[model samples]
Target: MLEVSAAREIVLRHAKRLKADFTALMSSSLGQVIAADVASDVDSPPFDKSLMDGYAVRAADVSPTAELTVVEEIPAGKMPTKTVGPGEAVRLFTGAPIPPGADAVVMREKTDSPSADRVVIREVPTAGQFILRQATEMKVGETVIPAGTVLTPATFGLLASVGKTTVPAYPQPKVAVVATGDELVEPNRRPKPGQIRNSNGPMLTAQVALAGGLPRYIGIATDREDVLRSYIAEGLEIANVLILAGGVSAGDFDLVPKVLKDCGVTAHFHHVKMKPGKPLLFGTKGDKLVFGLPGNPVSSFVGFELFVKPALRVMGGHIDPPTATQKLTLSEPFAANNNRPTYHPAKRDGDGVRGLKWFGSPDLRAMLDADAFLVLPPGEVNYAAGAVVEVLPINRTAS
Candidate 1:
């Protein structure tokens, strides 16, 4: 059996970044990677602009106190009709263009308009105060967002500022989720004895989307080799990653590994020494990845977070995605499995992490309020409250 780190490393070795680029609307590119550097088409602020609603005047005209002639009023989006000379000012609102010959802006609260054509200044003004100069933020043809940058709301805003309606970005990988087993039935149908609802398919689809991949759900595949082959062939043809839940453990019905090999997928690793995810299988063919996850819902859940998410990051153009782990004290005592490292479903308390009431691998109810998983290393250990432990947070924000 491979160690967790070793298995993960092997998975990443096969995760090649897709080099092709496609044009997509800026609004749809959030949380995606840019394929090429994007340059600004126009200078930011293009002209001298005002940062406040005030009088634009010569600095010497408002040294502590002065009364000045109000030449014109410049509202936002309206050009100034008059230039301010000595003892003169232009009334300007926020975001209005700074008029010619105006060097400073004194806030309206600091000055009073005694008459329609005249104004009084009560505060001194300095040169360039409240003035946004042309090209100060960005120049035309400058690189606004570099290549391989992960798109965020702020980045999209920046691109919009440069008049970019579309951007060259890498497409999110399309993942196919397939559930296996003749013992499985869709949630819409009531299951007979010795049968179970196919929860892994929907759960894995959600996981794929959360990791920034587009998920396509393929219905359950039965245990027969012919049925498995048909589903596997369809998945491989349509998606960049094919994820089949179950039929991976050593059993008479364990037909996924053999069928996948026949379909040209080279298996990288078959087992990992981790609780709940021991029978995780990873393979590749051409540019696509295939994962055969254990049938247990919690095992499938843990397997995706530990093995698949990192591969998605690399394929999405991240050089080094951070592991979302933190150290916290345990809020309650826990007695975990000692044969292998286990990740117990946990919730964040006010000042610590607390494990939930759980039964080994098959207990999906334990994950109801779980926001993280507490990592328990292999040992015959009884941890008391307040014992420091590491946890991996789920549903991390995209930045």
Candidate 2:
């Protein structure tokens, strides 16, 4: 029975950052953490340009009822050809380069086109009007996107604006799921007496993929030391994380601890003082993370959210891990007191969270309609209605 803080500390101390490579284009880099700071190679909008489709002219030439001769027309993408001289103007389009010696631009709507060669200005335009200065968006050699920034679509557009084609990011972590149970058969296979088709395997596999990790299904292992050790050894060779299911409890046939001990794996914490997932095990074999979850389907899912998701983020070089803890009012009273911290699958309705009624750990039926969990800490009589309590969302939007 370990405190929550103590358990977190143990997991952090025992965890190791993953060693892998990842590089992709900025468009494909969404949700990935940047490994290096993104610097602008050149000034954004590189040169002084016009921000409006108008006439580029010297500010001195602009006056009420003054007429200036149009010397040249400049469109976007091509450089300006003529310099704006006294009593001279250039027709410019949006994004066109400002011609030399031009200090202001008058909107076309403001000026009357008396003739094709000459234009009369009814309004006086001020200096620097409709001009976008160079390097206004970003400066050259300045860091635009810093390291550890989780790239989104907006960030990707920013990177592209700064002329970054490819991006450097930490590779997605490779997770190997080892579901150890003698009574568990494969999901596609039919189950016999005293056998249950493995639900944790497919569930955890999908969970890993959702967490931005590559999931490798290593199949099930019998509750025997030799078979479990062989599977673990194989997992250690290629996976950054080895997730073991159904062999962490203090049951007679739990062989995960013995196998890890024999393989010289370091155990951070064997048990956490949390209901539905008390027997969670966090360990490491060199740089690989080893997470052992309980046998129950519901407990396995909860353990992945509580432990494995954050661990994967840290290993993937993300500065901030996924978090879902938020304060919400409880719609019903909770009965689990001081014995352990309880995380009951719940649904959020309006402004409050309602914990569902179900048989404790092994019950997976209540979770189908559950959106999150109404978390209750130790040493509490009950959470009365209208009390603010922390809730951890288990839905996809939480991360």
Candidate 3:
């Protein structure tokens, strides 16, 4: 069995960043990663413009309590017909182009308008006052958005400002999730005495989306080889990654490994030495990746967090994955003597974290308040309150 760190390293070694495909429309490029530097088509502000509704005056001509003749009036989006000369001013609104020969602006409140054509300067004007200079934010042909930038709403607006209608970007990877077991039923159906509802399928799908991959739930597959083989083949064709929940342990009915091999997937490692998620199987066929997660819901969730989420992030060109481990103090005393390292569910308590109610890996209900995982090392351990331990944040806001 491979260690958790070793298995994760193997997965990342195979998860190469996608190449740039230069046809991503800005309309649909949200959450996509930029493949190349986006250059601005024109200077930001385009020309020297007014920053406020005030009088544009020659700086040398405006003195304290000096009167000046109004040469012209320029509103936003309009040009100034007359330029300000000596002892002259132009009445311009915000965003209007600065009239020639005018070096500063005085707000209306700072000036006394004795008549429509003349104004008294109550304050001395300074050069470049209330002026937004051309190319102040960005110049033409300069890089507006750098490579590897993730597209957000604000970045989208920046792209539009730079006249970038389309960008070279790497889109979210498509992931297919399917559960395998004979005693499984959909959530809508009432399970019989020997059956239970399938929560792993939908839960893994949600995890995939949270990890920046587009998830497609492929329903469930029974214990039969024929059915499992069909689902694996279809997932391989449609998705960049395929996650099969269950049928990975050493049972006679555990047919995921054999079926995946028959479908041309080359296994890299199987069975990680981690609690709640030991029966993880990883493989690849060409550029497509495959994962066989444990049947238990909590184990499946942990497997995605440790391995699959990082793979999806790599495919989407994201540098930071969700498995950000931090060392934090435990808020309460706890004891565990597990042979394997445990990632127990936890919630933030004040500045530290406290473990939640848990009863082994199958207790999916305990994960309801799980924002982080308290990493407990293997071997006999008794931790006192305020003991510092490793913590993995699954939900950033919750932690």
User: Against the true structure, what is every candidate's RMSD?
Assistant: 1.9, 3.2, 2.2
Locate the minimum summed-lDDT window of 10 residues in model 1.
20-29
C-alpha local distance difference test of each model: 0.88, 0.83, 0.89
| lDDT tens digits, residue span 294-326, model 3 | 999999999999999889989988866536798
> How well does candidate 2 match the true structure in TM-score terms?
0.86
Count clashing pairs, candidate 2.
1
299-389 per-residue lDDT for model 2 (tens digits)? 8888888888877878777776455599998887766654688788899978888889868888988888898987777676576888898
Clashes of 3: 0
Candidate 2 achieves a global lDDT of 0.83
Ranking by TM-score: 1, 3, 2
Give per-candidate clash totals.
0, 1, 0
Which candidate number would show the highest TM-score if scored against the true structure? Answer: 1
Comparing 1 and 2 on lDDT, the stronger one: 1
